[model samples]
Target: MVSRQAGLLLAALVALAGVSVVGGEVVDAPPTLTVENDGDTTYRVTAYTVESVEDALLTNFRVTTPAGENRLVTYSQLVWPAGYRNVTVTDSVPSQQVTVPPNEAVETEIRVWEPGDVTIYIIEEPDDETHVWSDMKACTERQQEHSIRLRDGYEGGGSTCASDLDLLFR
Candidate 1:
């Protein structure tokens, strides 16, 4: 039979080993970007902002590659709010466009080696007739306040109605 003192010593050693093992590795929190649709209609997300550590502003929708380098590639797609779709964006990588349904939310996991900021842009579709709720400025203001709404149409003569949501990474 094992003595009480021996058992206690073994337990303490195991605990110390566990701590040392964990201390030897560097762990970082996973970065995530989420967009929630609290409006009544669905909106298509066309672009998002990626601010690099060097303060370079980049857009995920349209990226121009450097000379002699591969074209900046961006994958855009649609996603349902409550589904098992696995969407991940690596560090310095652009995520695919995701259409967020009404009353639902979509998120992308961003893996960055350095700290930066991410801004999501929601472009409102143009309508034949002007709409009260389709104002891009209003929509942007609402988004900044964390209140998401449907962007059916814009009153102005612009081709697209775009809004942005900024997020920071440490």
Candidate 2:
């Protein structure tokens, strides 16, 4: 009877959640993107940022790999025509990107270092204090209008959805 209910629903998903189905597909539920360097400085990514909270900082694209490769990029989200809308426009995602092998209930692993190029900003906001104002300023009289609206050009869907991912640290 339908292969005995698909073999009792794949043996109750391999005895409850230790799933590893074959042919029916579910080998460890893959959908990954794990990059770890653990020091020895090699990060040559130069791009990867997707953490927005209603204001901006969402889309920025450009990927023409093949001049020495390093590719790993994926983004799908963009549909926030807020307030009174009638949208059905397809093609423009970034509502909240970056979740490759990283979804601790929607990502949050802050790490920042400077000296040009090595960006991996993916913090699906909600840690409060209005999009995490640096140095943890709970409130300081509007902290200069929230640091001048967090340095003005907050960057949302810029390039209207470019695309990138060159996280190479080998």
Candidate 3:
């Protein structure tokens, strides 16, 4: 009887693991990273994943250069909770600012100059005064990594870049 009970408990756990509901959408619950090529030959990336109740949302992103130094990137907005905004970029190569919405899914770009396999990170704190660190409930429970590229386009002797951002839902 003990063995049978253990089997039933394990089956229940497995069933729970397979169930996922985000924003009322039936999902498999995999962590995902999104990348976009914005106008002006810049790239924008936003990482979204599941989070524990204890985590906060004042997050940041980082891109590492071939030189081994990390360049902090900025965002124009946050998608969750609906109206948080960003004002400046710190430790970022091409400094920029953004306006974030609260608790919703968003992918706004702040800066991008080159193209390569980039490692994007979601930081736990805001970089400057204008931007508040992601709140504790805004944190992700599982960790994920992603790579993005920014391409340059030229038309009529002028340069025009566009963002073809990709959204991943897991």
lDDT, candidate 3, residue 170?
21
Q: TM-scores of all models?
A: 0.33, 0.19, 0.23
The count of backbone overlaps in candidate 2 is 11
Over 4 Å off in model 1, which ranges?
1-23, 46-93, 111-170
Q: Best-fitting candidate, measured by lDDT?
A: 1
Residue 47 lDDT, candidate 1, scale 0-100: 37
lDDT string for model 3 (60-163, tens) is 44434334455554332332212233322343333222322222233333232112212223221133222222211122222222222222311111112222
Q: Which ten residues in a row have the lowest lDDT in candidate 1?
A: 134-143
Runs of candidate 2 with Cα error greater than 4 angstroms are 1-6, 12-17, 20-30, 40-91, 94-170
Off by over 4 Å in 3: 15-30, 38-40, 44-140, 143-170
Measured by TM-score, how close is model 1 to the native structure? 0.33
Clashes per model (N, Cα, C within 3 A): 6, 11, 35
Candidate 3: residue 38 Cα off by (Å): 4.9
TM-score of 2: 0.19
Give the per-residue lDDT of model 2 (tens digit) for 17-122. Answer: 5435588754322112222323222221112322233212334322223343323222222222112111121224322232222212122222221112112322
